[model samples]
Target: MQLNISRGPKATGKTVRLRQTAMKAGIKEKNILIGTSYPDRELEAKVLQLALRGLKVICIDECREEQLAFLRRVKDLICNSVTVHVVVAN
Candidate 1:
């Protein structure tokens, strides 16, 4: 249930940075969810689905500040089983 944030300007390698952090954290590449866009309801569902299926790190790129509540929601629902790594543009 750890929360991590990669914050920088757009095109500043936040996604790559998060992946590196995930690698350092010992989470497998296959177990990491590399988010490609902002969260919608469909993607939100996928997040929870992956969390339930052993997704260790969630790196949501291009995140808006408001989207953090959504991340926290998923973290709470996952109940300390998964780690959340969020990417936010400055």
Candidate 2:
């Protein structure tokens, strides 16, 4: 399980970098799980997840500094099978 953290200001293309990293890790678009703070976006991610199988490439966007613990928990939960990448826009 690999964990990559991409931190930068808004519009810095963090998400783009994350996608590239996931691809490099051999995870396809169909097997990616993207999570955000927004409820609607999360719903969309859930829908996307339903179409995939096996370990996922979990990308959490807009993560805040204080949410490191939460992110760690998520990482631990799927550490065995997934690669967790976090993107924080400061």
* Candidate 2 TM-score, true structure as reference: 0.53
Candidate 1 per-residue lDDT over residues 13-89, each given as its tens digit: 77788778778877666655545453555556777886788867665656666666666666667757577777765
Q: What ranges in model 2 sit over 4 Å off?
A: 22-53
TM-score computed on alpha carbons, candidate 1: 0.65
TM-scores, all candidates, are 0.65, 0.53
> lDDT of candidate 1 vs native?
0.68
